[model samples]
Target chain A: MPTDKEHVHNRIAVLRAERGVSRRDLATALGVHYQTIGYLERGEYSPSLHLALRIAAYFEVPVEVVFSLTPFPRLGSTT
Target chain B: MKGTTMEPTSRKQKAEALREESRRRAAERQQRRDEIIRATIDQEVAPRWASRAGRRRLVGLAAGLLALPWAAVVVCWYLAPSDTAMWATFALCLAAALGFTLIANPLMKVTRGVAGAPDRLLDERQITERLRAQALAHRATLALLVAASILVSTAVPDEGNVATLPSAVFAVFAIALLATVAALPMLIAAWRMPDPLPDDED
Candidate 1:
């Protein structure tokens, strides 16, 4: 049997903030309830591949830039 | 050109009017749907459903509501407190069981976890969560039925004559079992659902 769902870290919050797009707006664009956007931003829910792609498409970015297995580096931190 | 000239202007006007009326009605329907959706979300965000502590307490209360009746039946059967005590117990327990089942069905609606809710009522995430909850509830309900069967078997003699058991006892078990089975999916979903994140400046 497969393991429990692993957390899929995402940059959705950062991207939404940078774009000045409200969670409601993003949720509407993605055809999900606004709370779902919050869940995605908090890494509590891992979106399906279709939803992930749609979210990325909404922000005009690749899915990789939006979601990753590893956490994204802290903003402005040197590697 | 001859056909166009022959067509009645009044008939054309009536058709246009009908189309306009239909459009207006459709818009009104959409507005009502949006309002209902907003109301439902607001209810979900209310303190009773939003906070973990509150939800846990409610789930526990719902459980106790059913268990209390079941326990009373068992006690009445064993102690034979009075000639009509078992019947009385079944009657009272039946009321409470029905009450809880009624409340539970609606509570699931607020959480969008009602197994019978139409697909349009839930989003993808909620749909996925509900499906998982129902699957778990199905397995749990099976276990409960198995346990109940074993307990009821004890009441039967080597003759396997269930008639020896008071018919009232059957009523007690039936109400409790039916109510539990009906409410299991809702209870399971409510208990397993995580508290929604506090609304931050969203």
Candidate 2:
């Protein structure tokens, strides 16, 4: 519906930790290299919408829950 | 139909079973290949060339690699050594080239997300990196070729005079430049690639 090439911050590491999924397992499930998982978590590599959706699906959460335009707040901090 | 040993339903079932087996085997093969790719990244890309220092060292080495052929050409230009010595020099340079490529190519592949990989095999991020690297390499190589061509043409002596550089040296230079052309993209991509994120759990 809209477009922006800027970075899309994600909470992959937090989600992965909460879900107890190793980077290797997540990468294997997503059909990408493990280092890609690392890159994505660190906000160095941005995923396409398709890949973003796939990742959201893998985590069984809404896409918004995984990705957001603004920086996600610290996990335990009161906003 | 009356004479047939099997009914149509049984034949269909057998065909489905065969198709299922084929699908299973294909998936199995894909999984195995994925494992190999993951292992290669873990061992080669992960263990080597991940540091800023290591990457910088390799980038410097890549510059030397580009200069390598030119160095060989210069040697031949200055001193047309004995035939045996010339051959030995060629052999040594060849070995060095091979060794350097073997060490550098993995880093390039990681940097460029499977450098030169086909479209189907690469993800969006990989495709972008590859395209950017290739575009840069193409422009750089074209400029180098043009400059070299101009220099060589200007160096050609007036009609009927002896060439300043030996014909053999020109041949060697051309060959070396050709190899450098092939190696340039990988080197550029490798140099431009950022150091990968740390491996620690985030």
**Residue A59, candidate 1: how far off, in angstroms?**
0.7
lDDT of 1: 0.73
lDDT of 1 by residue, A6-67 (tens): 87889999999899888878877887877788877877778889999988999899999999
Worst 10-residue lDDT window for candidate 1 chain B reads: B109-118
lDDT of 1 by residue, B1-202 (tens): 8777768886888999999999999989987876675555445444565566766677777787768667766766665556667666866687676767666544654464444455576677878877887899899989988987897676655464433555556666676777777767777777776666665564
Report the C-alpha lDDT of model 2 over B1-202, residue by residue, as the tens digit.
Answer: 6747578878899999999999999999987876565455455555446676666567677677667677777677666656853874586478658867676646644563455344556666667776777799899988988988897678656577656655667777887778777777676767776666665555
> How close is each model in CA RMSD to the real structure?
6.0, 6.4
Q: What docking tier does model 1 reach?
A: medium
Cα error of candidate 2 at position A9, Å: 2.0
Evaluate every candidate with DockQ and list the scores: 0.55, 0.34
C-alpha positional error of residue B50 in candidate 1 after TM-score superposition, expressed in Å: 3.5
Worst lDDT run of 10 residues, candidate 2 chain B, spans: B109-118
